[model samples]
Target chain A: MGMHLRACFALAVALGAANSAIAETRLDTDALQLEVLAGSCANCHGTDGRMVGAVPALAGRSAEQLEARLLAFKHEENTGATIMDRIAKGYTDEELATLADYFSHLPATAELTP
Target chain B: MSQPWNRLSRRQLLKGLGGASALPLLGAMPSLAIGGQHAGHVVVVGGGFGGATAAKYLKRANPAIKVTLVEPAEVFYTCPFSNLFLGGLRDMRSIAHNYDELRQRYGVDVIHALAEDIDADAHKVRLSTGDTLRYDRLVLSPGVDMRWDALDGYDEAAAEKAPHAWKAGHQTTLLKQQLEAMEDGGTFIIVAPDNPYRCPPGPYERAGMVAHYFKEHKPNSKVLILDAKDNFSKQGLFTAGWQRLYGDRIEWVGLSNDGRVTRVDADNLEVETEFGTRHRADVLNVIPPQKAGWIADRAGVTDSSGWVPVKPDTFESQQVSDIYVVGDATVAAPMPKSGFCANAQAKVVAAAIASSLEQQPAPTAYWANTCYSLVGPNYGISVAGVYRVTDGAIAEVPGAGGVSPADAPDTVRALEAEYAVGWYNAICQDTWGTQV
Candidate 1:
């Protein structure tokens, strides 16, 4: 099973590179490594992954919604959000999945406004 | 319309450079090659306020760009609130920041290494460990380097005895130690540096904080500021606060009154004035003249004035086009060299780099700053401004911001203190990840 898993991982890498041709030209895997996100979203978003107004609650965002928003910026669909778009364009699909998983599992943070 | 954002006047650029070397306004274009991580790598030198801010923002703005921040030290002791430590309001630990949060929170590649050399032509940074890191865009925000010879008989060696505590950290602790070991009635004199220095109101605030200590613990002790310049930021308010809080207990001498320190005798604890007056103080906090960090000079970014010249709107180095110099290291005309200025400049640079990289329309760049100085415990004052890049230089937008109301009502000053701390936290969030 271990040997088979290793072979599958190797094949995944090979296939991932082969599939790069069909991927969007702007979709760079390295720049968008969501695993590198430390604590930047905590200010506007609650530490527990809840978000303030307009920031959108990251607590239960669907993986598709997350990927779509990120891809929207990478493809230049959203030009209004400069910083977010630029940051989103740097993530790889695998890392994006990790972020989507992490945020989706966290409980929603409560809003501070009275 | 295709011209780079805005061209600064030659006079303004010269004034910005302050007579260093003549550098091209805009030189070579960056390769625009695909960086290893999709976005180009941003190599940041220094881990203090400015460098840390830039590194954090670069990652936050676009995580695709691999950000490698290099600093020699393990921890950063901020100069902003160090004065409070000297006055016994806070401890050294309270003011220190470790990059652990920055690394864990921002996913920044933190290299605990001193930037010994730079191969700018090759776009490679050679770390002290003999490791080489390449960058597509380098952000040099190494803060200020002290010009020791500016004061006769005072060099790095003399600094051991008469500590500057200007850069904070160990020096701050050393100065605090000296203050602690001082005789109750000992004279504490702070020699203020010339213009183009960090935290213009810092020395005055230090004087106020130290005087606060003297008033409470050692009523006979006094503090004096021997300044090089005639005017200072928030001068009227600082002086008024000093008069009300520690009148006659603190003496502030400026250039107009011959406060310029000519020389110092470290062994004798004596400082000679321009007017031939000699002062012998038990404790001397000599904040010397400063220049852009040595890394800027080594990288050939600095001109004659020992500061890097850059296009204000883009924050790109004039000498080396692909590289941008921000923070206190850059000669940001009409902008005081402060942490707030550095944070604002980091945002502008981040946006411009993103725009340039994506071939998108550049956004109109603006900057904001709010410098707060604590006059005493819970007694604080502030000056806030919103800046706009005009004619290639950052100029304060008229009537956009103002200083904390003069001799501010107690309620206002107290609120300013609260806002000041909040502003620090908010700006820190803008610069670093909000983990802490």
Candidate 2:
């Protein structure tokens, strides 16, 4: 999955947008999409956007600031980023906004420990 | 496999769920709070990534909904970082996780037993311990079992000789021992399976990791990949990484190149290719074709393909009701059967079940998969995608989730290697409530 991934990705976005319009009615498309999307970030950002170690905590962060950073990463402008930029590009602006708002509301707890 | 659950007598059925003996196992679950939101009980089979995540997320989604996780193991060893162990980057201790957090903190009843049977209609699951647990819903992350009889001369017996090590447990240790005992300059042959196997990038990453070991310990040793597939995920990145790190120490033989292994010999540690060519190995690792776990078949969720076909959004079994199948046992194409996908799918299934029990709207599902493979201990590559239920099946969101740039700097590869470990820790911690 080298250029093959990028090549297929460039073509699929159009079909995805077109299908979203039709799939939205049957699949609860617009409602609570952020729920699962935000949870997925827990793999790196920690559960509910809380961090356990060196990675920054997403919990209780400012929504506006978080969204701005996500947008920058998505746009490949986050100079200090690692895989976040790659992961961020997979999200839309609206999805990024929803994630930021969702995490911002989570109580900023201490670093997670098992 | 025998369908023992189907022959449950009328008396056993009555005793399994109705008898007073089952109440003790119920503990806090069967409270008669009828019409209350999230008052149902969930029985999750398997304690690996999917089942463990489902159990934890079920509790998180609704604390009132009782969750009983049925797993045979007390300590769960993860497949995600097992490769690092094989490469000598990490040890087995760092790959083990337990259910303490899920049980103590999340209030999940962790049952250490094999889930032997699933009477879907009766909403009952029979355990190997001769106990039957009743549930309002079931989540199965049972994972895959090797198709023991798929290849000729390759069965349970052959595995002991040339272990698959597909499931990260004792088999992992066995393979490591064989590798350690292998003579310098000996060949380590990895038999890669066909398409649609668990972790598409796994076999290649394994080749890279093993080559790393050979480079340091046995520079004269060769790592040969006899693949059933002609093309593979991240081929460019892996080939480049191999050349840069191990020179000509690693080699790949694609299916078209007569690399598809059709049989194996445990006594001699050898395998035969499709072209009737027999290749001897100092140590053989066969990642045989796989099917859904045995319990999935017993539950009647699997089709002729021996894999469960799940509804795209909720991962509900297309063939059965009240049971959701996740992880490697599922036919989730475009989204590879990696631990990341299972964890993501479990969240959606948990939300769907919680919403149904509480009479809420179905939550929209979005799945993201990022699979990282270590080329060398410090050299890593990845493929990622964002998916949703579109066109009535799970399809990747376009323009999102791509592989590492083919020409990325070595610094980027090294950094990705670090993030790969970070991703593993965060996900394992998030799922099992502990970072190993």
Per-residue lDDT tens digits for candidate 1, residues A1-114, read 223333433443454456433122222222222211313343334333454443445766775776566566556653543234433443444534555555664555444210
Clashes of each: 11, 2
Q: DockQ for every model, please.
A: 0.02, 0.21
How well docked is model 2, in DockQ terms?
Answer: 0.21
Error of 1 at B263 (Å): 0.5
lDDT of 2 by residue, B321-415 (tens): 98999999999998899999999999899888877775665577878888989999788788888887888989988777888889888898998
Please give the lDDT score at residue B85 for candidate 1: 91
Could you tell me the TM-score of candidate 1?
Answer: 0.74
Error of 2 at B359 (Å): 2.3
Candidate 2 residue-wise lDDT, A17-98, digit = tens: 5542322111122223345666688877666767666467788889899988988888866356766777777777776776
Local distance difference test, per candidate? Answer: 0.68, 0.80
